[model samples]
Target: MGAHRTSLTAQLFRRMPVGRRPQTEGGLKRTIGLVQLVGFGVGATVGTGIFFVLTEAVPVAGPGVVVSFVIAAVTAGLTALCYAELAGSVPVSGSSYSYAYATLGEVVAMVVAACLLLEYGVSASAVAVGWSEYLNQLLDNLFGVRIPHALSYAPEADGVVNLPAMVLVALCAMLLIRGASESATVNTIMVGIKVGVLILFIAIAATGWNSDNLSDFAPFGVAGIQAASATIFFSYIGLDAVSTAGDEVKDPARTMPRAIILSLIIVSTLYVAVAVTAVAAQPWEDFEGQQAGLAQILEDVTGSTWPSTVLAAGAVISIFSITLVVMYGQTRILFTMGRDRMLPPIFARVNPRTLTPIPNTIIVAVVVAVIAGLVPLNWLLDTVSIGTLVAFMVVSLGVIILRRRAPDLERSFKVPLYPVLPLLSIAACLYVISGLALVTWIVFLIWVAVVLAFYFAYGFRRSTLRQDVDDEEVAP
Candidate 1:
């Protein structure tokens, strides 16, 4: 262990250009602010799961699913706090990957990058699949028609092609190719649409609440609650999207931390409210196999389809935006890895024409499209939760490492409670991870080993930093 630590430290502390560091790329673009950051978090977080999670979670914990929501929220909040400190200290676009490289070491950074790629890449595909379901619902409600089951479902799920989902991905790719940005204004619009539809849901659902539904809240027992919490944990995955905009935030010392905590609080509250109302409007058992559950609840409550139609439309729009943002994030992280010579150079080449990593984005879009088209939503959601939980654990640990190794480094925001908070963050992450299936852990371990092998075989030899270090010693 001691020798391993020495090698890791040596790899991490190797010298490279300070001015041209990946963090210093193209100056900070001030296109986002606190409100916009919060909007991004809310927009990325609100859709898909809240509309559908109760169905999956309720069967596990019954009415006690509300408690699961609170537990997941608290875990997410702790990780987000650690993310805030790292984001503020590093102020980079690669999120946890960049933070890990600066503080943890190259091998750990590569592992974290792999996890992030899974987190954002798989999540984009997952959201696209969800968007397709909601779009079909909207069509059925408004036009009295629906896409054929074979064309609308995944191949594994006995469908031919998820045409609507593929179409959504294509449209988002075109928008990205056209250099369109999801500005703060657009995020605000998406957030408003999402939150407004949810508010409408809560109001309509209030009319149908039955106290009888609260009985037998924990039919599944403690084990069931933990299992459901693990699944529901996916809904909170993007809460740290707020911290990723660290460089653009005003008064980041105060604003960055506040935005993260505030976004988590608001999103968690909305999630619990939605869960409680959905379960109250109907028995917990009914949520199973119920796609677009909230919108359906509105339909049942009003005895009319318009309210549900509107909600479905809102989900369609908001979920598309989420896919776009998450895809953008995945491409950027790969771009950073490429710049560092960890992955192939193709990922690093920014298009001079678009000023975006056009090739990188396309590659990610294609991969995600395939996953969205073929994989089941449940598998996608579970893999995403595993990747995100591991990455969050790394970031929390990275915070403690940086504080101890480079105490004098300037930090715009420091996580409150110091060592204790970060330690708790790790514990919470592990607790949720424990609920994941043994198969998921096996798959995760294999994936990490493959990444580490690549790091040793190619990345170590091709690293730009190693080349720079050699050149400097030769010159002297």
Candidate 2:
């Protein structure tokens, strides 16, 4: 009985060895350089919110939405430092999930994985919904036609299934099945398209800027800005997705920190610039009820349909890339879990030809596509924010734990202020979480509970580590 209890405890606390070269042995390919890594971070982080969230955020914070951008950036920056340290120290494929497993324990890893599943899956679905909006805008600008509302939006949103969102998810899954290298290459191109269009809008929109737009900033005060920060916080969700590629990243220690910090700076600067220009182009109140807000702002400023058309096209292209990369992050997390025997083995099976997790990608694609076709955007945004915040907090906690537990572990890069930075990250995440609605918190708790129930019933009992123990005993 004592021996049996010991085996159960071992299974619960098992950790994946840090710095395992799984990809070179039997898994994903290592082909991403610092450039591609940075592109992945920026491409995934910049797309969805900047394009469409203004409509929801601006009225809440007034012109102080720019302040909200800065607040979110600072909060995310603190968390990114913790992520960089873990990625350098652990250097595994599962991002925060893998980090928690190595530094904390198996049960913690499962919980983190649940958080990540929500973050990537719901974010992909939300981005797909945003893509549907921009695609509709582009078509209307180019050819004077639109997808019927019933076919273009979720049923709960007063329409039928969102066809474009599902189609976009399906196409992205096909690209992912081809391989990560191919996906990264395409992501680089999409990043260029995204940046170029934003530059064009800034150049054109600055010509008609109004000083009066700056006068009434923070009309709803600090509380409003904080509220908007909570809403816009999900915009930075993908920055840490860069760290998930530690196994595939080149010279990960140096590359991971550089990519994480660089992507944060790039994404934050662009978000703030876009927000300031948007309000300058039109009054804050006008942002409410606005569809395709950025493009519409451009059209209003330039008095030409062409600039709006260009913005919409850029949004459609970049949001597609964002959805693809985010869904890629989701598949890899599942693949890692499968390899650990916390999930079905098929999820870990790599396609020999493509060197990708084909089964995992297909499963993620189908689930997110169904969600994209059905779930309303507003609910998804908060769900994603809550999940991402919890995951970030876990990574920050893991950093503190590993530092005390294994201080000798070699890390390429370390958080500058050590415990101070990680503690601040935790505090900041909780503060932001406080600003979320009560209903959002309730729903998130229920989701976590459901995931925990599945783990105890299946993952804890059938874990790969437990199977290994049984096999060893039989062999002796």
Candidate 3:
């Protein structure tokens, strides 16, 4: 009986061999370079996170949203380092899921995959929802006819359907179906346009800066700041998306870490600059229930519609890239899972001409588009934050575990300060996670439970790792 119990324990924690997925035929092509890789990170991280988040975060934190951005940035910076090391070391498709399978075993890997679905999949839907808002603003600016509320907003927002959001998701899916390299090139251009537009906002908004807005910086105090920090951490969701391109990244050891760090710096600067400029331009009390976001702020400050038009135009283009890269990450992770037989084989099947997963992208797009068309945007922020924070905590822990288990492992990037940095990464994630509301926590727990139940019933028996274990026993 003791021996049988021990055998069951071994089966439960079995790890997949490294580089195993890349060994398969018709695998992802390693064509992404440093510039395009940074584009993927920035493209995915910079979008509605900054453009749409202020509408929700400012109401919660008031002018203290600046502090919230700092806290979230620090936490993201720490986790980004952890991700960089693992991406360089493992250099595979699944990001943290691949890392966990190599160190923590199958159960933990499955949980990581669930977190990733929330991080990439749900966030893509959330950003698409944000896209609809900017698209309305852009239409109003260009054609003088905004999309009607019935066709523009989600059901939760009292609209019949979010057609614009669905259209954005579909467009991104089509671009992704073409090829990764082509998508990256287009994203790079969009990134450039968006960054320039944000700088334009700062330059113009700074002219109207009133010192009086700083009077009540922390109306909600520590709790408000923490809550806002958790909410806006969604901005950094795509930083790790760079690592999902593990199989397709050129000199991943060098490129992945560079892209992650570079994008974090770029995103952090823009978020803080935008937050500070917005708060300083208008009173914190005016930030509540704002729907039009940065462009509206520009209109009020400049007393001219053209500035709003320009900002909204940039947002429309940039947010499209965000949804594209995030959805891209979602498909790649599922592709790896499908390769491992953790999911249906169709997710792993790549189109020979495009060398991309067409069916998987289509499946992901349909589900995400449905979500974008139905759910409210604010709820998505909390769900995405908790999932990403938890996933980051897992990655930090995985970093320490891997170092101990394989001290001789060669890594292109190592977390500076060793265990201390990884420990702080875990602590930072916990702090941000604590700020999430009880309802959000309940939802997150329930989602994780459902994924675990699926894993036990299906993944446990059908996973390739399970087959390998049974074969090993029979061989002896």
Using lDDT, give the best candidate's number: 3
The reply for model 1, stretches above 4 Å from the true place, is 1-9, 12-30, 180-184, 243-258
Question: Which 10-residue window in model 1 sums to the lowest lDDT?
Answer: 15-24
The candidates, ranked best first by TM-score, are 3, 2, 1
For each candidate, the alpha-carbon lDDT, in order, equals: 0.77, 0.87, 0.89
Question: TM-score for each prediction?
Answer: 0.92, 0.96, 0.97
The candidate with the higher lDDT, 1 or 2, is: 2
Q: Rank all candidate structures by their lDDT, best first, as comma-separated numbers.
A: 3, 2, 1
Better of 1 and 3 by TM-score: 3
- The lDDT of model 1 is 0.77
TM-score of 3: 0.97
The worst-scoring run of ten residues by lDDT in candidate 2 lies at: 1-10
> Per-residue lDDT tens digits of candidate 2, residues 285-400?
89887778889888888889999999999999999889988998999889888987789899999988899999889999999999999988887888888889998999999999
lDDT string, candidate 3, 337-415, tens digits: 9988899899999998899999999999999999999988877989988888888998899889888888888888999
For the record, the alpha-carbon RMSD of candidate 3 to the native fold, in angstroms, is 1.7
Model 2: how far residue 462 lies from native, Å: 2.3
* Winner by TM-score between candidate 2 and candidate 1: 2
